[model samples]
Target: MISFELLLGVAIVAGFVGAMSGMGGGIILIPALTLVGIDIKHAIAVSILSIIATSSGSASAYARDHITNLKVGMFLEMFTIIGALVGASITIASSTRPLYIAFGAVLLGSWAALLFAGHASWHASTQDGFTRWLELEGSYPDQALGETISYKARRAYYGAPAMFGAGLIAGLLGIGAGAVKVLIHDLIMGLPPKVSTTTSNLIIGVTALAGTSAYLAAGLIDPGLAAPVVLGVVLGAFLGTRLLVKLTNKAVRRFFLVVLLVLAVEMIIRGLRG
Candidate 1:
């Protein structure tokens, strides 16, 4: 049963997950809370609110690093906001089975692509000249070069679809959609890890709030679960940020993928049981 104590616990955890993934809190909180007896719709609403708080807090720190390109984030945010509203509307009216399948499929596809993709450890020495000719360069830090690295960003045009899709998924799934945003920033937009991760964080805060509004309008939001999830996630995200200094995203992403696979199977099983 949903209770004040349970709500608080989930909120704390959600905050931590947000800090860690910029958008992973919902992926963790939703299924867990639903399993405990809250309706999936209500669970999603709580997850959405927690996402806003967590993303706002964690992304603020990323902004300080300057890797979050405000220009790109603001530009893409327009589409994401619209997509989030549409997606959340659908979620309130649909079953989650389809969303679970889609989430797993995207993760599976990303895993496969990452496996075959060969990324050269290269950065553009200048942000102008050739890069300007092609409109591809962006700035980021290169640990290997021990200084700021400026590189041309390729395939920025391809990012629009991905951004739209991420927004939809976030709203529909009550998740922050950072996983897809990071993918687009890193793969499609050719952003560095810092740039991609931080920029995704910068975008999620607003995106989540937009989604939260949609859920609230539908009266699917639950203050009981939301209260604790919000509290927990904000604190958790802060802790996760500190842990980021010690871990590689590759390791973190890999582990998250495995966990998702397991959850997908579990969701499938639970559905079958019902």
Candidate 2:
């Protein structure tokens, strides 16, 4: 059995990465827990609970700093919630191999898309009537850039459905789906990277809440495992929020991509071996 201290340490690292990248710590936590002899299903459930802690610890700070776009987060939440419930239900009946493969596949796809999009030169999209009506635009003070950055979101019509897909993957994999959410915000909606990440942080908590119901109903939530993870992630997430706001967009993107690539390969290999 994994020692409580060891699990706490792992959770802390997972939380920090999750908060920094807006990819919920579950991506890291689930793999670590499974390696420690925990069942994937239970690891997933514990990770889901920890996601709420990560969001709670980090999202508030981002919002208070005005880095999070509340309007965009709210609009997208509607789709994500519905999708999360459905995805969690599917996970209950699914096999672990496919879940691992799908988790890795999604991360790989997001990494590729972001890499192609490039690190610099993020421009606001030409807003259509629909996007303009939805008012999916905002500005934030970027501590890294030392200026106020203003941006307009475009293609809400597409972003909504994409977010649903993100939420589905989140619930299915016990990841916050923040990576996929960030990709949608950055690529489809044309939001800035900082905005994409911060807003993703805001959206993930609610998505997790929706997904948690299914797990709870199925009696998969183990309080003994979840307690240490939640406590550790909250601490790590608090630390991550402090650093993320000070980092440059390019730096943040680089960190995100590296983590994604390493985890993607690891998960895929594990899935294939099974």
Candidate 3:
């Protein structure tokens, strides 16, 4: 087994990578924790801690740049928050190994969706019905080029369902929820990549808060592991934010897919092996 200091070192590296990729620290940290003798349940609890740290640490920059679409985030967050609460309350568990198989499938789906999902562009907001009621349309500045990229939500009703689904997955898996949130923002909400990524970052903290309570109530939390992971995630997020744009788009997508696949496989093997 690796020493605690060594585990922290691994966490630091994972934190930097996850943050740079905008994948929240949990995505990377949970998998690493599994290798270090931490159970999946405990890993998830720690993941929640790490997510909060990275999100809080990074929210300011995204907000200051105006790349965070507060309107869309809050609107969709309503459903996500509700979903998280439900996930916390009623997630079925039967050896999460099979769950890992499902997770891998979803990760692959997320990867494929990103490959086909085009960059978000502008659209007119719907003037009628639930669209206006949700106030889902909005815009944000370009974090990369300092350009203001304004966009409107494409399908309000459809997007809400997607957000709700994303929230449920987040509640069950303890992921940052950005994987689905970013996709919805880009494809459904018509926000640019920078805006979607930043806004997702802003909203996940809110989502994690709702989910963490449930995870804790289920007796899944471990502060010893969570502390180091959160610390590592915060440090990594700083570095990742600095390099978010430096990596090529194709590279980012490909890397994200590969990483997801590995984690999925890891979870599957662990589930089956145990």
Candidate 4:
């Protein structure tokens, strides 16, 4: 059995990274748990739970600091919840290897796209009629830039469906799919990187909740293992939120790119080896 202290320590690191990059802690925690000899299904269940904790810990801080775009978060959440339910049900009866590889490929593509963009920041120069009607726009005080950054979200038609796909991956892999969500927010919706990360943080909790019910119904959640993870991630997430607000958008984008590249390669390798 993995020691409680060890799990707690890993969860803390996972949470910190998750919050920093807007990819829920599950992306880190699931792999660690599996490598430590825990069953993957159980690890996934616990990871999903920790995602909730991660969001709870950091989302409020982002929202309070006015970094989160609440209108955008709430709007995109509806599709993700539905996708999460369907994806969770599929995971119970399917092989995960293909899913892992496929998800990694998607991340790889996203990484390449972002890299090729070459530091061109996402600024919403125009909003479509639908986006404007929804009022999917906001401004936040940026500590790193020493000024307020305002942005409007566009391309809701593309972003909503893409979030469904993100939710599906989250439910299938217990990853919260925050990385994909962030990509969609930036690439499709034209939101700033900081806004994308913070808004992704706010949206992930609701998506996880939809998936958690499926796992709970299957009796996959082990409270004993989940306890320490939840506690540790919450603590780490709080720390991450404090630091993220102080960083520049470019710094956050760089961090996200690095993490996406590393995790995507690792997951693909694991899937191929299996």
Candidate 5:
């Protein structure tokens, strides 16, 4: 077994990357833990706890700064929660090999999206009736740009499925599913980068909580493993948030993509070996 201190150190770096990229620490933490001989599902369980920690730590500041769209997040929470429950149930019944393969595939998809779709501009030509009715629009200060940027959350109809998929991955893999969530919000819904990322962080916390109930019932969660993971991620997320404003968007995206590629390859190899 890996020492607690090593796990904590890994979690700290995971949380930093996660907070900066809007993907929760789990994407990094789970694979790292598994490499050290932790069971895949057990590593995932610990990852969920770290997600909660990073979310709670970074989300508060984002919300206070008015970067998170609360109404949008709440509306989408309905779809995500339902998806989380279903995904968690699947995780409990499924074998680990398939999960490893699935995770690798999903990470590959996320990497592709980051490479190709990350730069797409989102602008609604016309407000769809649903978008108008929900008032899915907002503005936030952009530190680098030195002005407030406004955006509209268009095409809620299409975004719901994406959110559901994100929740599925979150519960099944014990990730924040932030990459999928941000893709939907930023690419489909037309939210600004900061808003999309911050809103995703907030939503992930609640989504993780929903999945946690199922994990707890399935006897997958280990409090002994979770405690240090949570503590490290929480502290790391706080530091990440502090550094967010200073980092360039391009730099963050490049680093995030590298991390995803490494994890994706690792999972694929592990799955094939089994």
Candidate 6:
């Protein structure tokens, strides 16, 4: 059994990394908690709570910066919600070993995004019919460049299904799966990196809300476990956002890859042991 203080400390670090990378705290929280002998499902549920806290805490700043695409997020939420509900139900019914393997698989799949991170440019010159109809294009001021960066969101048809898949992963693993969400936005939909990341932070809270509800009903959420984690995440994520402006994108991406490597190994080991 892990001490409450240790759990809180772990969550704080997880939240900080999550805020920096837009991966949410769950990727770190779940593997760390599980390695410490918390039940996998319980760890996942608790991690989901932290995801909610981190996302909600960071959302205001992102929104105020006009980086989040509210219209696009709202439109995609319809698919995510449905996928979340189904995924949550599946998690509740599934066995522990399978969950472990599934978690590892998800983590492994996430590595693909990292490979493309430094090379991809998301500035789009063309908008699709869905993008035009939905008005999912927008711009934000880039303080670093001292100019406004405008971009169009194309390929909404593909992005929606990708969001549904992201939501499924979130609900099943008790994670925000924000990496996948950001990939859909930046890679598939051609949203700016800043916009995709901030929008992902905004979307994670609501997606976790859907998953948390199912966990709550399934008696998987222990309030004692969730409270410290949420508190830690909220505080850490707040501080992380404060530091974000000072860091370069390269710094964040490197940190993200290091964290992902560590957690992926942990997850795979746990799955195989089971």
CA RMSD of each candidate after superposition: 4.0, 3.4, 2.9, 3.8, 2.6, 2.5
Model 5 regions more than 4 Å off: 20-22, 122-125, 143-148, 243-259
- Across 53-103, the per-residue lDDT of candidate 2 in tens digits comes to 777667888899999999999999999989998899998998888877887
Question: Among all windows of ten consecutive residues in candidate 4, which has the lowest summed lDDT?
Answer: 115-124
Model 2, residue 143: distance off in Å is 3.9
Worst 10 residues of 2 by lDDT: 239-248
lDDT of 1 by residue, 1-274 (tens): 6577776676666556545644467777776676677777787788888788777776786677666777778877987888899999988788766655554454455445444445544343334343245454467665576898665666555676679888998888788878689878876676777777778877888888899999999988766566666777767777877776322467876665666567667665655554
Please tell me which predicted candidate would have the highest lDDT against the true structure. 2
Q: How well is each residue in 154-223 modelled by candidate 3, as lDDT tens digits?
A: 5767877788888777777777878788878777766667767788887888888888888887777767
Candidate 6: C-alpha lDDT? 0.81
**Candidate 6 lDDT tens digits, 114-166:** 74646476556699887889999888999999999988889999999989998
State how far residue 120 of model 1 sits from its true place (Å): 6.6
* Residue pairs in clash, model 5: none
Candidate lDDT (C-alpha), each: 0.71, 0.83, 0.71, 0.81, 0.82, 0.81
lDDT of 5 by residue, 1-274 (tens): 5789987887788777766665557877888788878899888887886777677667888899989999889888888877888898998899899889888898898788667753566554456899879988888887887998777778999888889988988998898888789889877887877788889888998999999888989999888788878888877777776788422577767877888899899999989888
* Total colliding residue pairs, candidate 5: 0
Give the lDDT of residue 161 in candidate 5.
82
The TM-score between candidate 1 and the true structure equals 0.81
Minimum summed lDDT over a 10-residue window in model 5 is located at 117-126
User: Which residues of candidate 1, in runs, are more than 4 Å off?
Assistant: 17-23, 96-122, 125-145, 245-258
Candidate 3 Cα misplacement greater than 4 A, ranges:
90-94, 110-128, 143-149, 249-258
Model 2 CA deviation exceeding 4 Å by range: 17-23, 107-117, 144-147, 240-266, 269-274
